[model samples]
Target: MNKKLCLGAFMRPISLHTAWWRHPNAAPQANFDFPIIKDLVRKLEDACFDAVFLADHLAVMNMPTNALKRSGTITSFEPLTLLSALAACTTNIGLIATGTTSYEEPYLTARRFASLDHLSSGRAGWNIVTTVNTEAAYNFGLESARLHAERYERAGEFFKVVTGLWDGWADDALLMDKESGIFFDPEKIKPLNHKGKYFSVKGPLNIARPVQGWPVIALAGASDAARQMAAESADLVFGNARTIETARSFYKDVKTRAIAAGRNPDHLKILPANQVYVAATREEAYRKKQVMDDLVHVDSNLPNLSLKLGVDVSGFDLDKPLPDIPETEQSKGHQREWIALAQREGLTVRELAKRAAGSGIGEMIGTPSEVADQMEEWLLTEACDGFMMVFHSAPDGYDDFTSMVVPELQRRGLFRTRYEGGTLRDTIGLPRPDSRVD
Candidate 1:
């Protein structure tokens, strides 16, 4: 049997490019426009993409004023709200929303995802994240962001509480028996009674068991703590690897960890993010990328760089090489990546920040066949199960990918040409989790 690829569309923020809104053909205010998002989701489903992944932000003040002013991501619909609405519009594509464990209540988060699973008929996925933005702390009434390890620690306990709540009732617990006047079998239901360090969510969620037992658990991050969490819990891991070598290393490390944790490696899918720019020709693709990169202002990149490194780079001279920097409370995985890029490429602070702003996991620029070649190579090499595709611009980039690249992949027998099942777990070949009530 041939290996198959799982593709996800990064829908929220509309585009990862800082200057996405500035593109000449880009849809104005596309991030906040439901019609545009609906259209995009429809396109993704029509092409048989696995999921529409929506990333959320707790604060708009993550960057400096000048940078924040130019950002296209400043205003957007909340992930759950938008995913719930999209659930109504899209039947095939999985709805995956980021729900931060640090700031949100486990009961509320579990209930919302369970409701989404029911609404979408078992097509919901929750991308578990610990909020990283320092400004987000202020919005949640925290004086400062919690340390990275502490956040992950809380996240681990939080997952237990939420999943425990999800298992409140047996799969066959519910029965609408009018004659007996019993809505459910009393003996089949169980309460979690969870008492963890960070949260004490007493179990039995108000809603019935989610359609897929618990909505598919998705996680993202490349740190040691993150890898451990993903190994033990995540059904899907959104990776950030720019090279095949790096990707393969990450792939082996996490899968090995998952195996050690008594999980089948096949159950966890690693999908690195890729910003694709496919056009009629390779040159045209590069030209399109250059145009987008040219629109980004240098001032807008400083705060973004700082956010990733968890240290202020504003004092560093732009023309000089990056100074020896000490890691702080930010994502060690991201901070390490940036430092390595700078040292490896001999890039000055200015050049490094610009490149970082342009593409994080790296861009796939070429014609449909060319882009498909890279994807096929990654999948065949076991570097990743698939990709979380990031479009450079709306409508144009979105259309080109669905119409061009998807068919080429389909022709190569690397991607699914049609839907195989109704639910997300079924669609992705992930097993439906058994109810933990008993």
Candidate 2:
């Protein structure tokens, strides 16, 4: 069989580009518009994308008040609710919603995903997150955010309990025998009498077994603990890297860890986030990038950069090189990446902050064919299994990628031209998990 790349569309209510909403053709307030989201989901499905990954946050990410007011960053619909609505309008495209283990109960999380699996006929996926924003703690009535290590520890137990609940009823437990008047085989149902450091539950999941046994688990984190969790439990891993060398290292590390954890490394797909600007020519694409880049305000984004770097770069000269600062305990992965990027590119505080506001992943600026060439190189070089595309603007950017890039990828035999399976797992070539109760 020929090697094919997996593609996922990273969907957000607002544009990832800081100033994208100000673009002339941008749809204002489209995040809350259900009709627009429905159309976008359909477009991705028609393009034969494997999944539409929905990113979520419990609170607005604005730290500096000025940035919050200046940027279009405040509004968003809850992810699960949005995914449920989109599921009704489309089929075959996996609906992956962000659900943080930090703020939710295992039983509710398990039940919600199980229900989504049945509703989508096994196209549901959960993007497990630990909710890193400190502002989110205030919203949840906590004085301070939980320590990073503690959060992951709870997440470990949380994953165990949720999967245990999912296995409560065997796949063959449902009988539906009308003549005998037996709806299910009682012997096939078992309770999860789980007691752990974080959660304790006795459950036989109320819903029937998911069509794919359990919805796919997607994880995104770059720390050692995060990578270990992905190796042990996740079916798909989302990552970010600014260079191919870094991405290749991450790819090898993840696969090696998966092997050490007693799993077939091929079963775990590592997809780094990728941003592209495609037009008829390379000049046009560069012009488009410059247009968006010009709209970013330095003062408004300094706090965000500071947060990522764990130091105040705001006081530094805009044209001067960044001073060496200690790494943040908050997001060490991001700190390391930003520092490396600054050193490699010789970027100043202003230039680095502006770049950060666009896409954390590096950009590909070229025509459809050129962009496709880069994607294929990464896949063939083992830098990544695929990409989680971060669009500059939805619908329009999405349309451009599907119309221009998708066909080019198909021409090169690097992407799927049609749906290959009924469920997300089938399209991605992941095996359907067997029910533990059986």
Candidate 3:
């Protein structure tokens, strides 16, 4: 049997390029416009994408004023609320929303995902993210950001508590018996009574067991702690490797770790994030990318560089090569990527900022056939299971991929022409988790 690719769209802000809104064909307000988002999602479903991954931020003023003013993501609907609305609009495609473990309560996170799973008829997934933006700490009533290790530690425990709550009720727990005045089987439910270093929760989740037993568990990060947790629990692992070699290595490492943790490695699907810019011709694709790159303003570029490096680079001399910088408590993986890129290319501060503003790991830039070729190579070579595609600009960029590239992939027999099943786990070939209560 041949391997099939599992494609997911990284949506919410709707585009990944910093200057996406400035594109001539871009929908500037699409991020906040429900009608636009609905249409885009519907198209993705039509193309048989696996999921729409919605990223979130708890703070609006996380960046400098100049950068904030130019950001399309600063004003957008919350992930769960938007996905819930989307659930009503579409069917089949997974609705994945980011829920922070550092600040959100376990019970609430479990309940929200369970509700979404029920609402979407089991086509829901939770993207577990530890809050990395320091400004988010303030919003959550913390004076300072938690240390990197501490945040991941809390995330591990948080996952256990949430999954435990979700498993509180057996699959047949609710009888809804019309006779005998018995609504449910009292013996079927289990109380979590979870006590952990970071959280304490009493089960069960008020809702019935999710339609897919538990919603698909998805996690993203490159840190060691992150890898460990994903190996132990995540059904879908979003990777960030930039090269085929790097991606293949990451795929092997995570799967190896999963086996070490006594898991079936095939249960963990790894999809590296790729920002794609496709066109009718390869030259046109590169030209479009260059056009988009030119639109990135200095205001947004520098601040993004600072954020990625986990240091304020605003004071650095733009013409000078990046200086030696100590690591901060932000995302170690991200910082390493940026530092490595700069060193490899010997880029100056200004050059690095420009690159960072338009950067994404393994950017696919070419005609539909070219893009399809790259994806096929990655899949066959064990570089990744598939891709979490981040489009360069909204509406047009999305339309191009679906109308152009998706068919190419299907024609090659590397992707599905139709969805395999209704739930996300089925679409991705992951098994539905059995209720722990059993």
Candidate 4:
């Protein structure tokens, strides 16, 4: 069978741009408005997007005090709560919410997703994250962030426990025998006496098996430890690649790891985050991107970038190349990618900062056909299985893709014109996992 492209909408209340809310067409208050979110999901569903991925942070993104206030990164609805509301309004589009293993308990996470899966009629997905922000530690009563290695270790065990809890009941456990007054088969239910290095979860999950067996597990981590976790568990891998070569490398590496883990590589879909600006003409699209680019306050972003990279680039001259600094322990994956990007392009501080301020991933600035062509090229080259599109503006950016690029991809038979199945797993071509209770 030919591979059809899998598209997911990477949604935040605001765009990747710091000044996105200040855009003339942007709705600055959309983050607090459910009606607007509802509209966005409806449009994505209409566009035949496979899922709407909602990224969450337990605390405001740690940035300079002024920058935090200037940026819209701080304020947003809780992901699970928002997704639950969205599930009530949409029929087929998958609702993927980020849940962190670092801060949340396995049993609670399991229950929330199970309920979401049932609420969305099996269209739910969980984007497992080991929350990265150090400030979040304080909120959870810790003084500092967990070590990266330890976090991923906890995450691996967390995944095991959650999936085990999801498998608490066999698919046939719920008989609902009305005449006999038997609610379920006790023999078919099992408790997960999961004791691991990081967690001890004893359960028969309160909820029955999710409609799709387990809600689809979506993971994003670029580290070796992260890759191994994805290989062992993830159905979808949200990748970060700035170029096709890099993307292909990541795709091959993860698939190889999956095979080594005794799983079929085809079951793991690699979807890189794609930033696109589409217009009627290529010139128009570039103009649209420039408008957002012009709004960027480079100085405001420097402190944040410095903190992220683990070396202060703020003192360096804007036109000078980055000084060789050791990678930070904060985010090894991002540190490696940012440095590679700078070295590859010989970018100056100003140029790199500008790039950081904009969407920091594979980007396409083109007309509808041009964008479609690029997407097709990437898919055919095996650079990625699909794309998780991050729009420049909400509703408007989303409107443009669905109106322009979606049709072009459909015309080329690279994307679906309608949803293929009821559950997200089915729509994404993943098999329903058998219950692991036995």
**Candidate 4 clashes between residue pairs 3 or more apart in a chain or in different chains:** none
206-247, model 4: which lDDT tens digit per residue? 998999998999999788888889988999999878889999
In model 1, pairs of residues that clash are none
Question: How far does residue 211 in candidate 3 sit from its true spot (Å)?
Answer: 0.6
| Alpha-carbon lDDT of model 3 | 0.88
Error of 3 at 35 (Å): 0.5
**Cα-based TM-score, every candidate:** 0.98, 0.97, 0.97, 0.97
Over 4 Å off in model 3, which ranges?
none
lDDT of 1 at 267: 95
Worst 10-residue lDDT window for candidate 3 reads 354-363
Error of 3 at 394 (Å): 1.4
Off by over 4 Å in 2: 310-312
Per-residue lDDT of 1-438 in model 1, one digit per residue for the tens? 378999998888788888888889999689999998998899999999999899998988566788888888878999888888888888799999999998999999999999999999999999999997778999989899989889999999999889888888899998899999998997888888888788776768889999999898999998999999999999999987877888999999999999999999999999999889999999999999899889988777888788767788999999999999897777888888788889988999988888867656667889999999999999999999999988888888898899999999999999998998889999999988888776
Model 2 TM-score on a 0 to 1 scale: 0.97
What lDDT score is found at residue 16 in candidate 4? 69
- List residue ranges in candidate 4 displaced over 4 A: none
